[model samples]
Target: MIDFFLAHQRNPHFTGRSSILKDLKGALTEGGPAVLIGPDGMGKSAIAEEHGRVNVTEYDFRLWVRAWDATVLATDYAGLAEPFGIPHQEDSDLQDLASSIRTWLEENERWLLVFDDAPSPEVLEEYLPRPGSGGGGVIITSKSPGWDGDFAKIEVGPLDPSEAASFLLSLTGQEDAEASKKLAEALESLPLALELAGAYIGWTGVPISKYLDIYRKRLGEISGRTSGLPEALVAVADISTEQVRAVSQEGIDLLRLSAFLAAEDLPLDLLVKTSALLADSVEMGLMALDRRGLVRRDEEPLSVHPLIQALAYSRLDDGERKTWADETVRAIGGAFSTYLGDLSTWPECARLLPHALASSEKVEDLRMGSEPASLLLNQVGLYLHRRGDLAGARNVLERLVVLDERFYGRGHPEVATDLNNLGSVLRVLGDLRAAKGCFERALAIEEAQDAPDRLKIAIRANNLGTVLRSLGDLTGALAAFERALAIDREAYGPNHLKTAIRLNNRGEVLQEMGDLDGAKESYQLAFRVFEQFLGPGHHYTQRARENLDSLSQSESD
Candidate 1:
């Protein structure tokens, strides 16, 4: 049976986990409770079973329990007795049977308990200790993080890059190194992701890169819209969420809320407090998440990949998202208001606000007079900017500026900051006239505020200068550039890379205006700044040299 599993494990199809296997061996030999933690299909069960049989003679008895069944209301000792074939005396009660096993283990020097997927921390901590005597140990493989006792936790991260590379090669049966690199990135180097990709590759007999494109399109179907993944891997995460949701409405609520939180290892208290669900519900939901491979919990923190989170969040449609977001926000706002004195709790409040805004009905209502509003606007700006939605980006920043001016007062640096941000969007959209107005307005505000926020002011000044140059207003551009350079030279000293960039910007402007000598002088100064600040080999310095060469060649002609 071990050989059979090993054979299945080795198929080029077999994703390697050398690191996890090594840690498993170390924990088994070290004589302590050991944990093998990872998501499903990463082969935690196989490893645990292999570890159990590694040294048959090392233990007097070894027992594996099917603890995941929800119908079993009994403890591990009683629940495991039938599987272990420990004869139950007709006269003895369940408690007596449990005691007898505990006594037997205490008397025996060798034993092992393989509690595969222990249901909950309460179950493990309250009733699931190893019954065996000295020299024996318990090995648990769980997706959940709660562990009590002196256990060595071995978290199984994704397969190593080399292992992943080899796996991809085998899957596609391809020899190209470039294709392998591209495939690895496509899979996020996740074992399950790679496995899914491999299956898709194997099924289609397509090129690895071609398969990657298909995989992305297929998986991206749910990327931001739904939580359902390909059917093959959905069970891994779905079972976890479903089980936790079944345990209680609160558990279900917690699971739903956690879907919106990041798919990284999260702290236990974070789920407990941030979730609108009850405390016990949160624990069960966590356990369910682990069991299903939707999440993998470790001693330190609970984490989920962006892919998993994407799927989970997709589970909520527009309506569900709105309801969840509303409830999450109200709960978070109340938590923040009531728990203001406890700064530790404040972060949870902060974390949930964005989630609330994801489906928030009234953006202004949620964002008004709040830090969350600023963060939301920034995130919106980022989204728009990435999508080349310059008009949309400008609108968000402009709104942010107006809101800041109304709430934080007219002279607040936030208003100036938004103006600069709006200017940036306008420039990107090629509306240089509007962009210039935005920049000049911001620069005037900065000069008046003079709030000692020189770094920010310097950036705006430099940007405004660039915009002016872009608009063919070289004189105005030159003035703005001079002011920016003076400030940067004072604040960051002459050799700073930012100063170099500004200098480079001015040189480009001079070159555009046909001032060959001035351009050459500015380029040389910029080159010196780059060389001194960022080293001779830096990319920007190389460009500066290229520009100088081009100008020198032109002069020769």
Candidate 2:
């Protein structure tokens, strides 16, 4: 006769984590306890629960408990008496009943017990089963870190980028790999948040590409009790917050400030740099946050999960949010070097660039102080332009223009500076007419000032000249260059590099306008200034010498 068989059903949405599962099973097979630990929302509980579900038939009895609090742990322990066949009455002493359950585990074999969402290893000691000759196994899920050396510990972290994207595609039936990858990254590869996003996509049929736009618009709503994400995620964040707050107020402050910055490898020293707080104080705060498993202290540059950042950001009041945003701006501006051509700034700029852009977005959205915003972002835009990311440069500069204009009026000198910087990017991006418009408006703004900033006007004019030259308006180009030269010659004198740049612009326009001797004279003066100021081996000097050689070649031909 054929035998009836049943299969252990698995969660269809669960994917990846094969390696972690292997480590867990290997640890469990030794007739020992295995611990799964990580930050909340990393899917530690899901992983542990999945392991239990699939191995139900392997043990004589299997049980799960939620042990997030002492009361819950006590009640769950007492409630497990019947499962292990221990006799108990409703009115019996709960402590005796729990001890009875523990005794049963000491006596019995082939039983597996799971402690899910354990508050800590200390709180968990009372309820844990002692392995007997019968050889039972144990599993635990927790956000607490540093399990004792006795238990086998498995760490669950964010999913790999590919696996996370695949999970979304599988769950939502989305066929686009790029969109899936984008969504996965935006969610920062956290499992519960990914599940929430995938569920939202499936429920609404919103294209994954459009989901982030909607998410940014509703970040506050989604992070709160009224959420696009499920309540569990918010609960996890709030619980974690309370845990950190209990141990360290400075940690809570740092976490809040972190919410307003980029959600990636934040330098460990940033809290001290931005807050002017003592390093030891910040170190203690970080250690406190780390022990609670709210932040990872092991990573070189500390990281906060993007979802954690979003939730923390949503918890802030408007005024408090603005204050954090200001702090972020100050930090970025203090370190972000604006000298676009300087190589020394590149490493630090690359490190801080992501945070700078994040801070810029926040400052613009809040309409907070634009001066600080510009201080950080102007360098960000310039650095991008220098690095050949014209589109990125344009995006950064455009944000600054809107922010500075709104905060300081259209005609403010700051507005002109933003316009001039943006114009440079637009010019490089092949939007000559748009660049011309930007430059003209900037020049007008600088020219209109009661006490004109001549150096500023010179910058505006020099940029205006190049766009005009690109547009074939050599006459207009020459006039603009001439104005720039006169200002620089007075302010910085004929020997300065600024005066040299104006002379080069002037020579180029003169050559184009068919005045060879005029061009030669201008080039010679610019070449001398470039050679003396920039050194003979500098690229600026080489280019200047090349220009002089070009004029001689024209005469030779």
For model 2, residues 1-557, the per-residue Cα lDDT tens digits are: 11001111243678889899899999988766798988767877567667766676777766666565454455456667766667865434556777788877778766777786776778777677654334677788877786885688888889999999998888777788898898788777878767766755664577878876655445454455533444445543454466567767788887887776765557546546655432346766787665444554444657665566777787888988888888778777877776656676666676676677777888888877667887787777776666555666787888888888887899999889889888988997799999999999999998899999988888899999999999999999999999999999999888999899899889988988889899989989998988887899988788778878888898899
Give lDDT per model, in order. 0.60, 0.74
Error of 1 at 471 (Å): 1.1
Give the winner by lDDT: 2
Best by TM-score: 2
lDDT of 2 at 551: 85
On residues 1-557, what C-alpha lDDT tens digit does candidate 1 reach at each position?
11212211223256566566678778867777788877654656656655555566666566654344211222234544554457863223445556656555555556676766655555554234453334666777777776655778888666777777888788667776677777776565767666545544554467877755655555554344333444434432443344456655654565566555433333345335654544643666566554444554554456554456555556766667655554544443443324234445433533333333332223344343444445455554544454344554676677677667766777777777778888888887788898888788787777787455777777878888988888788988887887788888898877777787878888887887889898898899889988777777999989999999989988999
lDDT for model 1: 0.60
TM per candidate comes to 0.40, 0.57
Reference-based lDDT, residue 88, model 1:
63
Positional deviation of residue 10's Cα in model 1 after best superposition, in angstroms:
36
Instruction: Provide the lowest-lDDT 10-residue window in model 1.
Output: 1-10
